[model samples]
Target: MAPEPTSPVAGEQQDRSGETQDPATYEITKPLDEESPLLSPTRDEEQEGLIEDGSVHHDRDETSETKPLWYMILLTISIGGLQLAWAVELSNGSPYLLSLGLSKSLMALVWIAGPLTGTIVQPYVGILSDNCRSSWGKRTPFMIAGSAATIISLLALAWVREIVGGFLGLCGVDRESEGVKVTIIVVAVLFVYVLDVAINTVQAGIRAFILDCCPSHQQEAANSMASRVLGVGNIIGYVAGNIDLPKHLWFFGNTQFKVLCVIASLALGSTVALSIGTVRERDASLEGPPPKGRGGLIAFFKQVFKSIRRLPPQTRKVCEVQFFAWVGFFPQLFYSSSYIGDIYVQPFLEANPNMTPEEIDKLYEKATRVGTFALLIYAITSLATNVFLPFLIAPSYDSPANASLRAQRGQHTRLSRFLDHLVIPWLTLRRAWLIAHLIFATCMFSTLFVRSVGGATALIGIVGVSWALTLWAPFAIISAEISKLEEVRRLRASSPDDNNNNNTTDQAGIVLGIHNMSVSSPQIFATVGSSIIFKFLQKPRGTPGDHSIAVVLAAGGLSTLVAAFLTSRIQDEVEIPEGVVVEEGLAAFGVLSS
Candidate 1:
């Protein structure tokens, strides 16, 4: 529903000296407490028709502070650097498990734990941060804690096997005993569990911080920068994972896993420190009355549920769009390497039916490398797209000098503005999905007849366009829309008896939580579904003439086609009727404008 029409906008303000001050020249030296971290005290044209229609006229102050571009750049690099380390942790997981003789099924359980922990933990953390009034700011403490956990988990993961072995020897158990094997299994699972929880915390903290601090207009830029960084991280991680570490200072002569874990610790720890240190926030608290919700864990879950119930229409729609989007994506992320590797090796297996298990493992390793190389190409393509596309595709805007012109024009309002923003980006996102899905579909089916490293690389690189959008766009849309409501709430806050606006802003954490719910819900399915297909359908490594790997890949391609269809059908923006401004004055809002 469209928000209630507001009273006429007040012009000019009364000065402390009993003079009438021009609205354009007004300054807000003091902050608006309980307002958004992203909201500037001064009003601008962009805020005028935020929904592309009428809204409460904000304080007419032009003296607003702006964040520097370098701040955003440093934030992205730090996150990207952390991703580089985190991705190494991810890429190394399966290999580390195999080295310890853990089964493929155990590896599947490990992967499933990530999405599970993410779905459960991130929302609670987001809610906690929203109401937190710590001196360092809401998000920084979480980021620091999560990073600390990541470092500890990595070091623990690296040395736990040896630590257990030494403990067993101390207890008079033989080093060659089965009890030692059970100890490795126990420690590995526990460490992986901690690592998963910690990583999710880091991602949630950083993401919320970005939304809290970045201006609505610049959100697309920030998200795209992060996406680009994610791509870079993937490349770095894969390369690092592939290296054979020389037997040096690895814990108890650790394998490649030790090298990766140490690198993960240093890279993630330093980057997280740098990121939290670089950005200064509104000094530790929002300068307003605390939100109206009852405090504590019960209120926390209640608020999350209530917020999910009351999400603005567009946020819900985006979640639906993403339900389909990730259905195709997570599968590819989980299984593309193994699927493609099996396909590439099918012919050799057909010719050498009786190959030894060692020889077969060698062949599969070579195939896996091909898959990794293709992923590198995908990462590079996504990076290039993320860096360059937004500016190239962005709309012409009113300059700072003409801050009020857009609002004054009255051409678009309310739902129209929402729709305008939605339509273009919606179309762009769907088009990317369509093109990428087509490419994916083509590659998947094509593999049945002929498989080549070049073909696999090309296919993934093409899909990277959609992948980049997936990483950036939904959050972009959610932030952009909710920020408008925030603008409405901020103005209303200045008006006594306007409790509804406060309620709207209270929805922030829950809405973001539901958005994550949508993200993880699909992963749960993909993890289970992909695991079934990979384990049951695909042939065991080194065995035999053929397997269902190509068939499974082709099925995922078809799923993407369906995902594209779902995306294309969404109506991207809200609808707002043209509003009639009845009057303008202090009494218009039952209170005087500043």
Candidate 2:
């Protein structure tokens, strides 16, 4: 009545008995009523396999097979480098632009580059990467090229002043002239835009790469690992930003910003290399090439729009959440450090009524570093949350059957058991995301009351918990939905009576691109809106009681509260094929099987 196993699956091997055995299965001679380790695998052993390539197997389909732990780690680790670069930009970009003689409003305008590039470049790169037929693989070529461009742009941005000065000197123009200053600013802005383009390309490619390689069952774990790595990168970047780098590492550069650029370049370069070198990406040539000519281009655009229109309900909800969450996120990403720096320097300004301009500037610079330290705390807290919290909460998409099995096998600790029995039944991933949004909103509103540097630091540090969930939850949810869709496609393809050839599974790249667009498009409005806020609320440099940053943050807080409400509206659970079980226990949290 059933088809026999033909060749061995990915992890199957012939045993001493000359029969293929799945690495994931074991003989259970004992009755179900008896106590037996064979009932369920130990959590540590399952996690060890996940982390250290413990023998595990899925179906023969490449898309469904579980990769080694090392493979997953290698696949996602480069995101850390990307995050490091972004962290540097977030912590220092505004300060650097100000040093280039841009006003607060103009600096906000300059930040428009990020959203603009993300909106255009991410989807474009995603579409291209999805169809790429290169031998180096669809994502790898883009990742390599993007990383190179990012490094070049980072260096260019860091030394824009010197580069402009030298060019002017060669042209027989005065280096300190207004013309040279304007040229430097223009060049810096261009480099910033270039950096955004490169970063977005790499980001889209890497996210797609993960989706392509990780099967549905492993999606949450893979994403959580990526989040942890990103947290590590942010920690490193913030620590570097907070330090007086020029003082400690003069060989890197004469200025802190220059040294920070060099450090980010190295970090990004090394990680990108390691990831691309070790991972063997599947050739996408089999997927066929992009259409050529004007008609082809028109068709591509039509397809993109069609895909957007046909987004799954879950993916659409995730996008809606992302839109509001990112709107709240932008203010913190762009201004948290700067806001804290302002708060830190206010007391010094009050104490020294007659401070010299140079003295005040030096104090502000010191205050910025203090703000960077607060970001360091934020990063550390985020890292810890990513590492430890998953064990305590159930993962998204976990079935009740799997939970019951884990309980029967005595896999949960007392704390985990209590959460499983009482807390987690109600604390679904969507609800957890709702709570994170509320937490973020609370922190943002708290900024209005923060007068001391320590208070600001504490507030930002608390925001890290929300940041971890934001990084992990939405992606996990989307990936699971994508996986489900893929499973449906596989089932359809296998069904002999099925004649629906039009049901093409959605490409991860395009879905992620759409997700990215949602995230970025809002920032465009947020940036312009913030620029308007700064234009109206920003006091002149010496204003003693300016609270413009707080106002902007409070506005962001209001948006986050809206996000929380939207998060609650998301459908946390979806029906799957009956008897289709995820071996990994606790779906949303990526808990190991019992």
Whole-model Cα lDDT of every candidate shown, in order: 0.60, 0.75
Best by TM-score: 2
Backbone clashes, each candidate? 13, 8
1-594: candidate 1 lDDT, tens digit per residue: 222344333344455566775443443222221111111122231322111112121123211123466766766665776676566554556645655666555566667777788777888887777667776777788888888898788778878777888888888988778879877877888888898888878777888777656654455556666787787877776766555453554553356667767776777777777777776544435335456667777887786776766566557767777765666666566555665565677779889889887887667656766666666677777777666555333222222222233345553466545533433322343355455555656666665665665676677667667677777767767776665455445555543444543344443455576688777777777677666765776444466544454555566666667766766665443212112121221122222232
Whole-model lDDT, model 2: 0.75
**CA error at residue 495 for candidate 2, angstroms:** 9.0
Could you list the CA RMSD of all candidates, in the order they appear? 8.0, 7.8
Candidate 1 residue-wise lDDT at 52 = 18
Task: Give the per-residue lDDT digits (tens) of candidate 2, residues 1-594.
Answer: 111112111244344467765433422111111111101111111111221211122223444445566877898999999998898799999988887888899999999999998887887788788668776677888898999999999999999998999988998999989999999999999999999999998899889877766766677778888999999999999999888899899999998889998999998989988988877666555433444434455765776677777676678888998999899899888899989988987877778768877886788788779989999999999999888776555545454555466677776676554444433445566777798899999999988898998899999999999999999888988986676554444333343443433444556778788899899999998899899999999976645677898889888988988889889889865543223233221222121213
